[model samples]
Target: MVKRTAEQRVLLDQIKQIADGLGQTLAPFCEVVVHDLLEPEQSILAIHNNLSGRAVGDPTTELGQARITDPDYPQVLANYANQFADGRQAKSTSIGIKDASGNYIAALCMNVDLTLFRSLQMAMGQFVQTATDGPKETLDPAGTDALRDRIDAFAARLATTPRALKTEERRALLGELKASGLLDVRRAMETVAAHLGVSRAAVYSYVR
Candidate 1:
């Protein structure tokens, strides 16, 4: 193992703390690693939330190797597709760290396992699955339910029941219904009066 300079050692230690904190915060689902680029043969300095089953002192990854070869390699490679050796899919982000001279000295990487999210998506799909070819029916063919729903919503907005609406409120509602052509529906006056707990003549009076 190559000996690290004091500055390099401090930087790597700080990155290990970050990896540990991130690993705990995102626990059981994400893996966080810090690699010491100076020692490519045993690059991995730390690994947290070990999803990929890798260990400290493991060799550098292809990405780390690339950074070792080129100082100008992308500093941030985000949300790329990756997979564990066991074939679990992953979403990965890698950030290359540099020393004062701009030489890539270390790397911080995160790998998020997609297995749980994929399982959740499939379970939800099954939970909400329904027969698309079944006979379709219009339960409210005449839109009476819609009209009743509107009345109930309006009354709810006023913090009252339809049957408890004051006379003026009923008049205003009747005027709105007339303007919307709901009053032209067959037996609409009867429906409105019944919902308002009043006589059909009362509904006519309000509309007039």
Candidate 2:
């Protein structure tokens, strides 16, 4: 085991403080850890958020090995992808701390689980779906003029112009059109794209 100097101890304390702040700020999804390189067998000095099922006395990771064995190893590796033991996706960043003699002494690591955000995305998608054959009126005869009127009405409901509608709004409008069977008309996508000042592909993307 390596001996830690006073300066090394102070550096570890400061890094642990940062880990605590990050853990609180990104709570539930993020995990922050500080490792003591001098004691690789029991390197984890602190762990926050506790997402990975690890504890304060967990052993060092492969990253810690690089820091202990490689004098010229990089000090920081930011925004790289990682995973947990249970196979959940994560985005991680690791920072190596060294003392005045260029000896690696400690490390600060952060891992953020992305499953929550992905689940939220799926929920939003489901919420936005509208049922076909609902009571809403369909476009009469499915012509360009009728399509324009439908688009204008939907845009008005949102207090925005058709040309100013965002992607989500456009998608919602397409949903309405599909429910009304207006999207089944010949050249319907082309007509809508022309009215929205966007490409035909962009209009199709909303439905797809």
Model 2 is weakest, by summed lDDT over 10 consecutive residues, at 136-145
lDDT of each: 0.91, 0.91
How accurate locally is residue 203 in candidate 2, as Cα lDDT from 0 to 100?
91
* Per-residue accuracy of model 2 over 90-143 as CA lDDT, tens digit each: 999999988899988999999999999899999999999998878978664457
Q: Would you list the clashing residue pairs of candidate 1?
A: none
Candidate 1 residue lDDT tens string, 107-142: 999999999999999999999998999998865437
What stretches of model 2 exceed 4 Å from their correct place? 126-208
Query: Each model's TM-score, in the order given?
Result: 0.63, 0.60
Best by TM-score: 1
